[model samples]
Target: MKDHETLGERLAEQGISRRAFLKFCTALASLMALPPERAAAMANALARSQRPSVIWLSFQECTGCTESLTRSYTPTLESLIFDMISLDYHHTLQAASGFAAEKSREDAMKNFYGKYLLVVDGSIPINGGGVYSTIAGRTNLDLLQETAKGAAAIIAVGTCSSFGGIPNARPNPTGAVAVSDIVRDKPIVNISGCPPIPAVITGVLAHYLTFGTLPDLDDLNRPRSYYGTTIHDRCYRRPFYDQGKFAKTFDDEGARNGWCLFELGCKGPTTHNACATTKWNGGTSFPIESGHGCLGCSEPHFWDAGGFYTPLSAPVVNIEAATLGAAIAGAGVAVAMSSLDRNKIRRAQQAHEKLTVKEL
Candidate 1:
């Protein structure tokens, strides 16, 4: 590996203008929940420190994670490479294959060992001596263990690597297991999603490279900033859910009117992810924004959890009562005007209120 370039020189070589680079720094500071002044400090730290090397390992996965990452071409390729961490070896990205490709990975580990990041996208099948997935005539189990030995910190990239994924489904033939199951000693951070949001993946890596440590993680080892809040908390259709206006069917009036998708098997309330907040495809929209309910792909065991069209949970508390109580107390004039000659509306309101009271 060449000598590490200072941030200023690196950014210059990467062709990122000073102003744009600073804006990137500002975004990073905001994402990290740090103060605006922290941007300059982060810039200083980044300028002095070397660009961290990253080795991406793919095992029993569908390449969805890589697809999500490559779709990160928002502003430009320079943005992805210069701002986020550097990718030293990615079998998918690297042109080399066979012994040459394996040598490149070995070289990266040797050159940046104890400092490079190890990102595994799929699970390791230990059944039958790991013959399920092999590279360069070696099983994934052997390759992963060998790579993890030299990594400074390990990041299980997708649900596959984080939680055994679909390969560990019922009547398992491969006996797949997550990286955490095998490498129990290292600092492993799991970004558990079918294919986690691109921003979140890069955000975590950026946080580690810039801040020199992993961000505060939840009990499930997800970064708190990204996964701390539930999708329901930041949902744009929250008003509909609170108002008890749900889409009963996919093509119903409620769905057409952009109402909530809770009744139709939305897992938003229980799902912890940054999809609703950071968004996808350059902050344009997410699944919920597209009029579809969340599948809870980010949570563990989400695959076998339940159908996407099933209610997340039975309402233990009366949501309608609470919403109506606020409305009747505050919007008295509107309620009074609309209360008359609306028997169906009034009855529905009362039924919800009664349910709420019953719960209480």
Candidate 2:
């Protein structure tokens, strides 16, 4: 319903109404943690400037990353994907295939060389000389490396691509490795999670589109604006934990009262992510808020740190038969105390004992 132009100019020409554009700006402002005025400026910038080109690469991973993007219903990511920017390559979403798909990627890479955003959603397995995955007869590793050669910035979309997800877990028979492992020279912004929140994914993209750079990131390469604080810090049950009130079991009265889940092995204290705040399905609710403990899904090595049912710090339980002889070291001292108590029942003995002790 609007004429085409640079993203900046488009915002300027937003003939629909200020209500819609202002709403979009408000979303951007909240995500960026910027003031309203700043958000307005960001909106103007996006509406006036040319939309950036994004090339999404799907490698050895499930389509969960794409699924997350599709779940972004507000503003309808379909609108953003189709109207906001030029999505030149996406194997799952694109209608073209075979040589047409490969050429589409190649053409876009050449046309927008060194200026397009590269989004990857899976890790590259370097086993057997990186031949595990091949697209268009080229290995995913080779394709990633080659594509990175001219990309402006890289976005590692899912946990699989960001931190090797489950593929790179212990033993790692496939020898899976993240994008950062192979594409070391470029600037990478990692959005790590099995399926990262839709808002988070779009927020980062919108921030880059508005500001022309990556969003502020934490040490783990996740956007600090979203993942800076641990889930426990913002959790509703935090007060209960501080008060030492806890839920002993899943279906107990404590749970009914929405008491602290710490005793139930909540990992929110150590795990960092925006689940508590930016919840899935457009800020509905997170797992912990909905009668479930946090699984610490966003953290690296989440699958191996411990089990979902295991306590965050379970007490040591050693029940060998060898400790039976170690519990009776003070029997003689107990008998001596009993003898002294019996002697104290005699008044003359009590007084005499006190006098003798004093003289000694």
What's the TM-score of every candidate structure?
A: 0.84, 0.82
Clashes of 1: 2
Cα distance off (Å), candidate 2, residue 256: 1.7
lDDT of 2 by residue, 1-360 (tens): 333347645545555565677787787788666777786687677776667778899998889999988998544677577557778889899999999999988988998899888999988999987788889998998899899998999999888898887888777887899999998899999888778877888888888878888988766788878876667767888778777788999999999999988777676766667888888887788888898888666776655554565455422111111122233444565565344323322322233233234433
Error of 1 at 103 (Å): 0.8
Model 1 lDDT per residue over 1-360, tens place: 244455666777767676776777787776666788888777767666677778899999999998888776332345556544567678888778788888878998998889888999988999999999998899999999999988999999888998887787656699988998999879989998889887778778768877789888876787878876667767889889888899999899999999999888787766778888888888889999898999878766556554667675433233344446657777564664344213322333343334334433
Backbone clash pairs for candidate 1 read: 265-309, 265-310
The residue ranges of model 1 lying beyond 4 angstroms of the native Cα positions read: 1-3, 14-16, 73-77, 82-84, 314-360
Deviation in angstroms for 252 in model 1? 0.9
Q: How much is 237 displaced in model 1, in angstroms?
A: 0.9
Best by TM-score: 1
The segments of candidate 2 whose C-alpha lies over 4 angstroms from its true place after superposition are 1-5, 8-15, 314-360
